[model samples]
Target: MSHVTPALYATLAEIVPELHVHCVEPWCVIGSAAALLAGADVSVADVDLLVSRADADTLMTLWAERRESVYEPAGAERFRSHFARFRFPGLPVEVMGGLELDQGDGWKPVKARRLTLAGLNGLAVPVPSLDDQIRILESFGREKDVQRAKALRALASSPLRGED
Candidate 1:
């Protein structure tokens, strides 16, 4: 299972409901997780979530016990957000609130232009559309991100684009 495994889907199904109940603002899965959800051939190490700052605070407070205090997020200079990591059964989950990206210009908010619901088992996991995900990856401007964007672009042009 190079992409999402049964264990990972189970972990997400167990956790996402709690987030829906607690988070007041809209939130969606992002990064490689979203790419995987969109049927891209990508490996996902952890789940990345995009949420409102208030929602992030709420989740952080709610899951304080699960917080990984020692783990520091990378790309501090290129990205800024109220970020926190939580431990789950199958994988680690990272939440970024009010995320922004600075590509040498000024800081600008990073958000999904369109969200697509990915059906995983019984859960309707929200993720950015393939095009939006590609745009976001390109905006990051990292070599790895650019590569991921290329993967997503291929998916977008493939027949499986609307399957998600």
Candidate 2:
């Protein structure tokens, strides 16, 4: 099962109250939420948020939304009868897929590596550099998953340099 903590969700709202943060995993709610507040492009789902670091914000408010037990993503009406969930191998990842954010270098995409993803108060959201995200996705053994992740990873990780 995917583990999404209540503190993470609260931290997300505290960080970004504006933008839509697309989520890859449940735990990454904090960083993706911040991305929206920071003026980055965002996508939101019931369980995850995808955003860029340049647009992400650090939380100033204490974690508050812990009381909310249900996270209802919009347009989930079709899934009402659903009950089971699935867990795939990879970063115990709060943030899974990478998104595009333009740093000084140019419009490029990045993701957080396994090492940098863990933080003290919250799991800092992350997206690896495009090539890096592809390399990382390639590392996953599931062939079908690799195909999908790599495509999204490539789209977000633009400004392709070496081989991509």
Model 2, C-alpha of 121: deviation from truth (Å): 26
lDDT minimum window of 10 residues, candidate 2: 79-88
TM-scores, each model vs. reference: 0.93, 0.26
Error of 1 at 59 (Å): 0.4
lDDT of 2 at 141: 32
Deviation from truth (RMSD, Å), model 1: 1.8
TM-score: model 2 vs. ground truth: 0.26
Off by over 4 Å in 2: 1-61, 67-126, 140-145, 153-164
List the RMSD of every prediction in angstroms.
1.8, 15.4
Give model 2's clash tally: 16
Clashing pairs in 1: none
Deviation in Å, model 1, residue 61 alpha carbon? 1.1
